[model samples]
Target: MKKWAILVAVMLLAINFSFSNGAGEAEAGGKEVVLVYDGDAFFSLISTSLAFHEGKVPMLLFKDDLAVQQKFIDDYGADGLIVVGRHVDAALPCREFLGDAVAVSLKIAEFFGKSSSVVVMPCSMDEYNLSLIATPIACYTDAPILLYDDNDDEIISAIDKLGAENVIGIGSVAIGNVHLKSEEEIYDYISDIRDVGYLAVTNPDDALKPEVTESQEMSFERHMKNIQITILSQKINLVGSDEATFSISVPDGISRIRAIVDVP
Candidate 1:
């Protein structure tokens, strides 16, 4: 009997997500910022909380049930109001009242014109985390944020609805996975736009420590056929070896790593 075991170790990659010094100023010099959130706790927490914290933009929970919108208008007295989604009623007085997240975002992008971009994310709980991750980009670009989910067919129907063509995605979001890229790539893209410091560190010891390691059996016949494993984009080939031990070398600057083995 021939047995083989492959030990894979990956180091943790740390990237700097610290807020920019003048990020708050990006939202200033325009108007007293008001973010019209859907008022859903989960959605607001992940979507607008960081924007409020980073850009000094106060969030107004826009729910149709509450008639406090007028109070918000009177107290804050915002020069312009930007709505995150259409579900909320816009009774506030403003130069314009836009409907739907996409539409509202487009209205704000008008200020930046050709230099503007929009941040899109899935509306479901699983995907809303990207909103928080991408909030800094939104604040920096002064872009509008739009969210979508699997069920909402109208989610993407409004992407180009407002005539804003420069579109960017934060996490597991795209035009049907056509531009599926790694998270590091997205962060790098944001860094390019903002020119901020990014740091990444890798620690593999914690990840590889396991009580039990899975083993595999290779017969003479299978050994003659050869075996291979693929991790990320790297591949390791095992041919005619009864037993072997090896350590894979991953290049620096790679923010993430994953290992996969296929058995047939």
Candidate 2:
């Protein structure tokens, strides 16, 4: 009777462990594949949207240490890997998107098949802000975000091949029948859908760094406050008085700002 009880207890523990492991895998959305990219390259970051569009797979920056990368895969329970960038070489069962940003974008689009629409944004390998804004929109819309150049034959050809009826352009990109939008306009449009949350702003000077370690949450918080100040200043401008005095109150717990005597 004692031996039977011990055996039952061990079996129960094994079943519980298996259940919890299955639960974790389900929580990870059964996405047992992760995309790896070189954090040191700006283009690598931009191309990550391909992975995002491909089943919303998770992405990790490629650490120099192979052990670290393998550990991440184990933690995420991922069995397969997709590597982006020509220089990134991951030692695993993986598919590689190897090329320049434009080439990689086109290849990924072709690999995932086409949609009725394609997002065309100005391509700047050095600047990331515009691409960052475009990534989520592309993923949400289920359209491929192609880096645009002025009258580039390759981009025009890709758009034609994709059979994209709607060519949505962001930030001064003027392709054929493309709907161009300014940065401010894009911000206003996405503000409705995007939750106001902490942002991690990367420094342009440190674009080539292997990893980003600083938190810019406080800086972003201040930027939000500045937007408030700008709105208040605009309202004050509506008074249309050359010499009007007004008191500005700073909310509690908010950082103080310099007096805006003559904000133009």
Candidate 3:
């Protein structure tokens, strides 16, 4: 089955939620950064930023990685949240990575307006850690969805056309089922602003292994630049926040490039 097995556990206890009614003023116009993660590591990252700058904690749940962070904000339209990722990926899922910033900004009014908001670094991510969000994307009620995976060109093109018609079209390739398009064609195809997705990466070594030729990387970046929509990737950083830098150790050989939504 392409779908992952998600273990859902509800916190009946007064789960240490971050929303503090008395913590700070609404500051109606101030930019509020959302730290999306489920454990101490991500919380600590949010705390570190608080050390240098003041912030308002979001009441929403989150993961330590930027990918998941973006996913939550995009779907539910929260104040903002963090994302997660593995350090070993060769090609970073740009759509999922970009979700952290875009989702929060679009949902949070202050961020959408002209303001100097730096989304704050997405909670530092790690491996396939359990994030708070293990739910499926059910964003739109009436939109038709087309499921595709690696090498399903026929289905992908169909989605593009449907989306162009302003139809609520969703792709199930966030599970890494869809194949990567050729470098040049990907740019033109995914550049449209109406696209959205849930992303996943089943092959970490292929995505993170550092062996891309300069030409290849350029093609990859070119494809990424054209992606204005959101996507998903696996290896979520679901660790919640604490009072330090949300830190996660990537297995040896992962890329050193930093991931997640940026607020710093």
Candidate 4:
């Protein structure tokens, strides 16, 4: 008889500074700078993307390394900084927004002015995957994505302040004028406005740690079968294998992965 053990890993890809589109054009006091939370402040992370996009500012991670932050400031010639989350001893003239996730998100939305629509997702940690999906849509649609708690009234007030004509809810949440109940529905809705593709690939244990080439390319054909679709007049193929393996490349980085496989 063959014995089988299944191992699963879910990787939560941290939103890094490299994701920013560079610094925004300078304003009156100085150039607009990106504000980042030093910790796993999920709501702040989602809200900041909208703020940065609307403001057209560059973003950097706020870790214990003040020197790195200072270098970013000097390199960009930034005179003022907008600090998100808790207060920090910034190296430049800065404005801080401090509060819980809901408060912080409301502040960000208020700072950027108003929006015509709002995207609301569950605030609990378990619903992070939904937030991840909703984020890009919010940014692209120029809408604010707020984390909603069933008991929380502040979200309602925040929506009122935004004067949003449309409210979009992800999952089974009670809010939103329109609710997207599943991943496929969310993807389909966004696809109408933009091209979207999702791929999940699994590999055997030995194949997980491929050689870290300068190009950082992994041969998908070796591990998985191909799935294809057409969006916006473009063709996209998603490939995945039956075997499951998981690993993380960054030290001290947060990742979540889920894998299911049969083994002996």
What tens digits encode model 4's per-residue C-alpha lDDT throughout 1-264?
211111112122222222211233323343646566767546444544555353546666676545667776677776666666666675455666668776677776675567888888777766665565555567556777677767458778888888988888887678878898765666666666543233223343312233333333232223456677779997676665344455536435324333343343
Name model 1 segments beyond 4 Å from true: 1-38, 41-58, 62-116, 150-157, 161-165, 176-183, 195-264
lDDT preference between candidates 3 and 4, better one: 4
lDDT of each: 0.44, 0.52, 0.28, 0.58
Residue 257 CA displacement from its true place in model 4, Å:
9.2
In model 2, how many backbone clashes occur?
Answer: 0
RMSD of 1: 18.4
The candidate that achieves the highest TM-score relative to the unseen native structure? 4
Q: RMSD of each candidate?
A: 18.4, 19.4, 22.9, 19.1
lDDT of 2 by residue, 1-264 (tens): 100000000000001111022113212234434344564354544455555555555566665545566775777666455566644444434556667666777776776576787777777654445555545555455677777656478878888888888777776677746554644555554454444232234443332223433323221111111112246456333433344344445557544344323343
TM-score of 3: 0.19
Off by over 4 Å in 2: 1-32, 39-45, 63-65, 87-91, 125-127, 176-178, 191-264
Backbone clashes counted, model 3? 50
In model 3, what lDDT does residue 64 have?
39
- TM-score per prediction, in order, is 0.39, 0.56, 0.19, 0.59
